[model samples]
Target: MRLCPAPGGPAPLVVINHGSPARAADRPGLRPAACDSEAVQWFAARGFAVALPLRRGYGASGGDWAEGFGRCPQADFARAGRESARDILAAIEAARRLPAVSGDRPVVVVGQSAGGWGSLALASLNPPGIAAIVNMAGGRGGWAEGAPNTNCRPDLLASAAGEYGRSARVPTLWLYTANDSFFAPAIAQALHAAYTAGGGVAEYRALPGFGEDGHRLFFGRGGSAIWGAELGPWLAARLGRPLASGAAR
Candidate 1:
């Protein structure tokens, strides 16, 4: 886990989650985001103490791989998402216990790729203290067989999203790109339609493509500028004020 504490004594918490690697073998080598990374600094500058948890079964925190969604044709996306959510929820609780993190302010959950899918699952639980979720290119079953835009089972993925939306009342921000190689615009729109149709509260935004693949927009260099413009106002409305200006060192 990597923690970047805000300058203030106690501040709102933001737990950022990493995505699942396309290759199964890469899971063991995954690592948490650096504390001083641009993404973490962005939150820290905004008065949020950031915690990046390396979920179980990934990287140095290896255990049993609990997020497998079974074989492709009939992947159990819901189960896999739930398992991922469990870890994120735990991370939130643990982070809140830190002295630098205030319990009064609501928590913000941010995730990319599979991590974003987990954030959606976490919303269904409506865990207290979680005020909002920011899903950046979130989805599973993407790039099947290493092919761009290929999905393992998009139908099942959409179904799982709807299932989560049935009880997810927390407001969410869904950010995607026009040229995502993993989950294309069409797939992203379908997932959003299913989620909102099932009663999930979400605001969706599709931005212009970035770099080779828009899927990496959340963590890619210079990526923050594009997403931050949209995210800043959205977060201010919920937090009741604007984020602190200037970057945190």
Candidate 2:
């Protein structure tokens, strides 16, 4: 885990989860091997000690892909999400052991794409010190057969979401763009509905389309500008008063 502490004493934490690539080693060449440094910097500027955990079986942390859901035709999305959640929880425990971090401080988990789905699954566990979750274009089993926004079994996805929502107590922010190629607006709404219907506390916001694939919102240079306005108040409410003057932080 790469722990980047902000410019403050024992700042709160933001566990940033990264999305998965098709191949274990293929990190898209553009994105880093671990969490996006740009995102870590953004959270750090806001007085958050960020912990970016490279989950098992991805990148340098090699093993059998623990989060694999099986073949597309009969994927087990629920099992896959739970498998990914285990690594995230382990990362949180690892972060809690750091001397530079306060174990009791509020923790906000922010993830993109597959990472986002993992975050939702983590919500069900309600790990201690976690205040909120921010799911940016979060979903699983997207791009089935290389077709954008076409999941293998969307009902199963919703069912898994409902299962997560049934036991989740953490508040989550669901942010998706109108043109997300990975998860279209309709699918995003269905996921949100399933979550909320199952007693999860979530706030959904569908933003305007970004350049080309909106799935890159959390990875782009100016992505925070679109999410910062809403995130600031949410952070304040969950982590106490906002110490950062800049909204972009």
Candidate 3:
């Protein structure tokens, strides 16, 4: 689904990728392709064309869940993430055809959770025209059955971050929360450290704790207020334009 303001001319594009469903059984409901309405409006109102793609194996675009990452104990986080990136890149290519989308303008990729991780992987490729990336609680592993913040292999996840960071050139903004059960501040910090140490240009912000799960921040009703302020300024600086004060609201 692609949403945009009334057409005038080509405008800056925002590729908004969604996260994967928690369970495989949920794929059937994906046919309609769920999205954060507030997020769509938030970016659309700000004079950007937003593209939301329902990747393969989900929604009507069913095929296979290319991003399975193996199973629990030995999950391949990196492989799964890169596979997701492949779909996102394909979406970018399709988005270029939207009449309201400007192919030459700065492209900003925003993703939540698994989607965010995919965005990070995409960064490693340094795709043409992508100006920056915003990762909202980006990570691969989370909530293992009864355990909280217990990923399959934390060390491997950090190493994967370093692996992506090594080839990433685009500046990235990562948002997380102190109380996130998925990737707590400590682990998030470790991953950030590894990524930066590997030469990735990334700015990480650990916001104050949100409700029960900060991982929901990007999709929650008031999520914009938390990420909007920081994002507007970053986009303005990156795209060499001034954004309206309350544009994100």
Counted clashes in each candidate structure: 0, 0, 2
Q: All candidates' TM-scores?
A: 0.98, 0.92, 0.92
lDDT of 1: 0.91
Off by over 4 Å in 1: none
lDDT of 2 by residue, 1-249 (tens): 778766657877788888887444574232332334566666776777888887777656655678888887677887888888999998888887787677787788998888999999999888777889999888888877777867888888888899999999999999999989888999999999999999998999989898888988887778777877777787778776775764323
Off by over 4 Å in 2: 23-36, 246-249
Which lDDT value does model 2 have at 216? Answer: 86
In model 3, the Cα lDDT at residue 159 comes to 88
Q: Say what the RMSD of model 3 is.
A: 2.2
Candidate 2 has which clashing residue pairs, if any? none
**Top lDDT: which candidate number?**
1
lDDT score of residue 206 within candidate 1:
87
Q: How many backbone clashes does candidate 3 have?
A: 2
Candidate 1: clashing pairs of residues: none
- Give the better candidate number (1 or 3) by lDDT: 1
Question: Model 3: runs farther than 4 Å from truth?
Answer: 5-9, 31-36, 245-249
